[model samples]
Target chain A: MEPGSEREVLTLALGIAIAVVSVVKRHVFRGLPRARRLGIAGASMLVAWTATVLEHLVFFEVLDTVEHLAYFGAALALTSWIVSVPRGFAEPRGPG
Target chain B: MNEALQIAASLVLLVGLVLTPRARTLSVPARVAVAVLFGALFVQQVLDVLERHRVAWADPVGDAIAGAVPFLWGGLLLLMVDRFHTRRLSAQRAQTDSLIDELPAAVAVLDAGARVVRTSAGWRQLFPSAPLDVPLSESVGPLPEALAAALRRTLADELRGAGDAERVPGEDRWWSWVVSSWQDADASGAIVMIQDVTSRVHRETDRESTQRLAIVGELAAGVAHDMNNLLTVLQLHVESMRRRSGSANEASLRSMEEAVQLASEMTHGVLRLAKPGEDEGRAQVALASLVGDTVRLVRSTLLRKYELVLTSTGRPATLDGSATRLQQMLLNLIVNARDAMPEGGRIDVSVVATEDEAQIRVSDRGPGIAPELLPRIFTPFFTTKGAAGTGLGLSVVRGVAEEHGGRIEVSSEPGEGTTFTITLPVGSHARVPQRRAS
Candidate 1:
């Protein structure tokens, strides 16, 4: 098989496996800590995205790999903010 | 394709190994075994990656890689199957161990070879320090021949799938046996689960006894009610007779009145047995103060020989219940603690808080309730204190707790001392407390 085709196949399989894993996590990790679950999910998505970026850089070499990496880095930052931002930030201080 | 198959097979093996069970909590050896399996799979992945990229491989490196690939693949396959088998065996052992551990009855298992395979933890209560895998007869040596025969027959019938055999009850212990046949890849075996069943069967018997006591309590209440009514009528009639007779028979009238009063007192005793005092209402009662008060109330019973210590987190914890009922509950616990230490030891009352509940634990440094009796301690009217105890104390405490949306549990070993825990909802009435007034 062509290296490019095999790489594409591997990437696809990894994506499918990750999607299945995320669904399994939703079903199985019901009792687990929410923060831990989010961490695992975020890490898995980042890893899958990194793999995709590496595959494209190796084969197509169209866009810079660093740009894709930076995009995932931003995604991670967004995930952190989404998880940690307090709902009651605008509430008044104590005793007032 | 071959490389992909190897990878797929490796993935399957890795998944299987990760899921194996250790008999105890996850052990070091088991974790190491899992890590080694992962390492082998990783090496295989690296080899496939190297070959795919056309990396310059030295002759030795190529041969080594090729040799290691199949070896690692084969090793992982064997290891996965091995781990699966081990996990199955461990599970069976765990099931057997927990069966013996938790069940208050003595249990023993016999294999197809009629060898003793598993025995319940309760076995030691009867035959202490007995060796495992010895012949059933040798272990049952202390028992009578007839009892031994019955036990063996039960074990045999269990192996044959003739349903579990029920052995004749022992003079000293209660015995029940369940046998099952199993065929593993390794060997065919019979698993005999021997249970002392003494406590369970005894609890059943105690239940019957409690039923009888309840009947008796009902009868006593009926008789007392009737007698109280008669005495009330008699006392009135005697007073009238004395009034009419005046000086003619004052002493006889006095005697009649005294007899009526005595009968009235007797009726009170009967009533105490038939219907324990009932209270209604929910109030926040501090546990520390309650324990202190109970200690004071039972001060004479302690007789300076035993110390009643009220240990608390001092958080001013409160439970919603009738203070009177709380006092009665504490009094029963204190009295029980005092009685437990006839030779005398310290009784510690610990009040602790859980996330959503308040826990009051009464622990005694006395000969704890025997393990056999631990489960039955909460059953109504089942007391080791014989005729002296009404056996209604714990039952009453439990009833009061349940009424307040709480529960009472006891944990004890023969020598390790007993802890009676009363857990009540943290705040009063997230909903209404169920209470009945008399």
Candidate 2:
């Protein structure tokens, strides 16, 4: 009902959606290099969502810090993955 | 420290964005989504910094951008994953196409409507005019009608799989085809494979002819043995009769002996045909004498309605070859000429000696071969005569000529006549000139 509460809900929904998509299309990531970093990024985003939901019950300051840390972790992993993309990714790897 | 970590993460994200190879690999929309994703994360980092510094209006902006960040990540992940799948599929399709193209057998894939989807290199070689996306029957090539009809039937589900070897009309070639229906998730069609089996068919025919010849040789040997015994008995009786009835029966006895001698010579010719090994060894053969002998043998067996004429240039035309095989070759040409004229016509057999070769010609005043059919006349198992012909005559003549280091040529006028000329290299043996004979 609050002005910012809706944004939290939407973020939580998107995190869940991303998790479901990753699980369903898990085969897509099998051969990719540094794919674990991408998974870590997704896990960090999920953790941030959980911390946002638990902020009212737990130590508010601590939970807020935890959420920001999780977001930072997700951003760091995502950036690492982006920078690590191989030059040959554009070229096809299979026989023609 | 948390705000410091956030600023570090944002800076790393910005650096990654600038250096990521995905900028060149990803599609336009995907690249934009990636940029937006990094921007949102950077904005969140900026909001964290501002809140840490007690700036106003940071909370609301942080909430809104935070909400958008996850969606952007989701969109970017989906886009990159989709791009990977597209590349993999494209690679697999390319591999399949190359595999098909490299296959030795002519192969084609058709849609449910029987239109060609793809073809192999062999298919292109076989049907150079056949183009992609065209109905096979409409393609300009020697695709047999039977194969096209079978393909249609197969695609229509009226036939499961069809295969046959068909001789191309007007061509001495034979093609074999196999068609089968294939069903995939998105489509159903037929795969057609074709092969040129002309040589295979010829080899099988030659094998069968060899088998038949072996059987005929055995039979001829037995008949020749019996005929020789009968001629020997007749010769003894003629000699006995001449001694009993002195001068008065001399002429009759001599005629009886001459008939017996002719019968003996005929039996010898049959024996020679039976035991090919006896004449397989090449020797100096006088073409004129061989032609005369063959004409005599043919005259004795031929119908009286046909006129047989033999001529020579009086100059000896000697060749190093199998005498019996040469005789058989001449016999086949003469018989072929005789068959051409059912109403009986003049067959001229001639031997002419040149400086380096001997030319033997058999001319017939019967209907000649068509011009279009000339090239195929020497092809094994090709025949112009309906059911009554064996189609092996000219091919045998050609084989024997080539075997003797010679060549055979034919010229024909459809209504007028046909002449078969066989030229053999002259042997190094001494040439013995003789008087002109007819």
Candidate 3:
């Protein structure tokens, strides 16, 4: 495998693993409104990684453009989610 | 346009990472993970921008940074989720502990190892010497042995019900407790709930004593009534003998009549005790004259070991009450004062009349009541004088005062003398003459 292909394949595997773990522990995201936005960011990153891996095989200009767009989407989602997160979201809440 | 959008997204992400309030509470590792995630994403975006502009060196660097984005993002996601879960659980535990601590009843939670894990405010009060994280048996103060045993039984799943009232070994306090075993998926323990029942126990005992006293009073009243009738006949015979006899026999006959009169008065006193609230013979009685008369009567009956002084404010302190009952109430107080000063101390009896009320104060220079015993002084069957006292004198005084729409108050210092003040409402009729005590 080419050096570029190797990096793409490794990135693809890691992205898939993250997506799988998230699916398996889906309950952790339940009731967390911020987690939905986080899930969007993670999914977009996975899409970008998939596009990168596919570009190594098919070598299309559109695939490369798609990869950049997906990366931009992931970054935008993550930034938006962080900005919108309420103050003390990380702070422990008192029991009712 | 895509390049500009990518750069703007990267810059905003970096700014959000810096400005977000969520970043403030992030743990060290979580903060580092987030920073690294943003760094990798920024590098990927920059390298992509450079590569799009046909910089040959940017290809390799862009590929390397791009491959790390997913890995860094994934790591950050997992770290934050785990931290949130842990913090939520900890907060929930803290809330539960706070709720338990504020519970009104004394409660304690013990682990399976019999170590006390948590306690309520009431529990802390009840066992101030008992500290947390210690076994029950190793508590500092005299831990009620029964409570410890109950906890053990609960933990063993042998006893899950309430225990009887157990007296604290050295203390007068009583505690009733309930112990139950509690188990969840992660842990098993016993929840012990204790209630202070000392007051309730005292109330129960007092009720029983009052009931017994009522029965005894009824029996005594019946016997006294019969004896009173016999004494009335004996008095008639003594009077007849006195009228028919000469001066030689008059002294002995007069003594017999006086003995009969004394016996009759004793029976009437007993009858009054049995029916204290009877309004049958109530009349407007002059208190000053009554106090003087009672004082003289007491002076004549007892040995003049202690000086009995009587003073009356020259105002008419009259009451529309049974004169016999009023005299009885005054006599009980004076006699109690006399008994208190067994070693012969001065007894002062004073009658003072205000516009609305009349006060009869009997003070004795006796060893005053202990501060602890002062509250229960007028409680029936409660006494400092053990065998020699029936414990009914002060109670009768209070009863009579209350029955006549009055109140009795007492003040004492341990070393100083004690004073009993009975205040009665001044009756509407004040025409009675005030008599001075000799």
Candidate 4:
């Protein structure tokens, strides 16, 4: 097989394997926040896609690195907010 | 197309969620089915990855196969669930059957079809000839006709909507029945449970009659007391008249005097039944002293040839009861023991004390109480001695014991003889003075 087709096949194979694993681990991974998980998976996918595009395309811009970093920073802030938020914020029991 | 498949798959999952077994309220079978379904779905996804080439995340056919595994798992899960539940049900049913069999009261169950489902040994013994239930109307013939009719109507009402009913079919027997509905896989039926309450009812009736008789006895004693005083006055006047009237006949005077004696004895019997000095409160009594006094009082009369043995250990057993009452109780017990050994046997009267209570035992070597008569010995006016025995001796003994917050018990075998045991509580010596005041 040509290298291009071989790469396509390999990526597809990897995606299917990950999908199976994701389904099986869904019950175990239930403890994590859904939005945070989605954000992480999305960020990883974008990073891998960007690196692949960059290897072929030599275009560069000063704003690109800043934008990427900003996006990652925003993601980290959102995750911290979710994790630190107390569940139900129960009233402390004591004398009135 | 892929988005469309994703939407369909999402809908399928939504449907499954709508039907998911609720954790708090789901049955064992439903819970197992849910778990199996979720597991099977995960397995199907693994299979799809192993078989397929590049596939979109939302390919309906691929995801459909994965989703359908849950339904398939439901079928397999239910079979195993059935086996588990069946074993559990069988165990519960076995426990219920054994409990019914071992019940002391007669119990019977009839199905909605009016067939006898089961009957306890007690039930069989109660009505051996009860025809296999064609219906309640046909089977229970020994029951009073009016009672049977009332019972049938009550049962019909219960069958219409679950309820309970009770009836007294005869003077000696009581019956209660309840109806309830039961559902199985393909059939629904009603259960009828019948229980006999004869012994309990009889006990309650006897207690009521005894109370009524006690009231009557008190009234009779009151009337007899007044008459005795008047008769004594009449006899005194009559004797004075006989001496003052020098010409009065001797035979008439003798007859009148004999009549007066008979009336006096009758009046004494009434006074005894009334328990003349019972109004006096309980006093602390020494067990050894009481026994000695009782033996001495009865030593004057020797109606029986029996050897009397009176013995006690000096345990200082004291009771909170009137001395006269206690003496009377002991006298009655001694007389009973003496009478039992008419031909010539031994009588042992002993006082024993333990940590919590004190006991006085009067045992006789006479023909022991018949097994059937032992239970009824304390009933007022129940006597084996026809006219010779008033049957009030043991009953009065029990009454005295109870008035003192004590109890009397009798144990016997046919050939061995009988033991009458009286148990009284042991109070501290300090309370003796206070008890005397009360």
Q: Tens digit of lDDT per residue, candidate 2, span B1-438?
A: 667677777787777667554556666777788778878888878886897788879988988898888888788787877777777667767878889889878999888988889889888998887888877766635567787778778988747555556887667678888898887558899988888898788678767866776787689889999989988988998888888888898887887888899778668867865554454356778788888988998998899889999989947877766787778799899999999899998999989987688889999999888898898789765677855665767987887787677789999999999999998877563333221121
On DockQ, the stronger of 1 and 4 is 4
Judged by TM-score, which candidate is best? Answer: 3
In model 4, which residue pairs have backbone atoms overlapping below 3 Å?
Answer: none
True contacts kept of each: 0.00, 0.58, 0.51, 0.00
Docking quality of model 2: it rates as: medium
lDDT of each: 0.58, 0.79, 0.79, 0.58
Pairwise lDDT winner, candidates 3 and 4: 3
TM-score (chain B) for model 3? Answer: 0.73
Q: What is the lDDT of residue B253 in candidate 4?
A: 78
TM-score of chain A of each: 0.35, 0.76, 0.83, 0.36
Residue B102 displacement (Å), model 2: 1.3
**TM-scores for the candidates:** 0.41, 0.74, 0.78, 0.39
Better of 2 and 3 by DockQ: 3
Chain B TM-scores per candidate, in order, are 0.48, 0.70, 0.73, 0.44
Candidate numbers, best DockQ first, in rank order: 3, 2, 4, 1
Error of 1 at B345 (Å): 1.8
DockQ (Cα-based) for each candidate = 0.01, 0.52, 0.53, 0.02
Candidate 3 residues lying further than 4 Å off, grouped into runs, are A31-33, A88-96, B1-22, B51-60, B97-145, B148-199, B232-253, B275-289, B299-307, B311-321, B339-344, B352-358, B370-392, B402-407, B424-438
User: Which residue pairs overlap in candidate 1's backbone?
Assistant: B105-B196, B105-B197, B106-B195, B106-B196, B107-B194, B108-B194, B109-B192, B112-B190
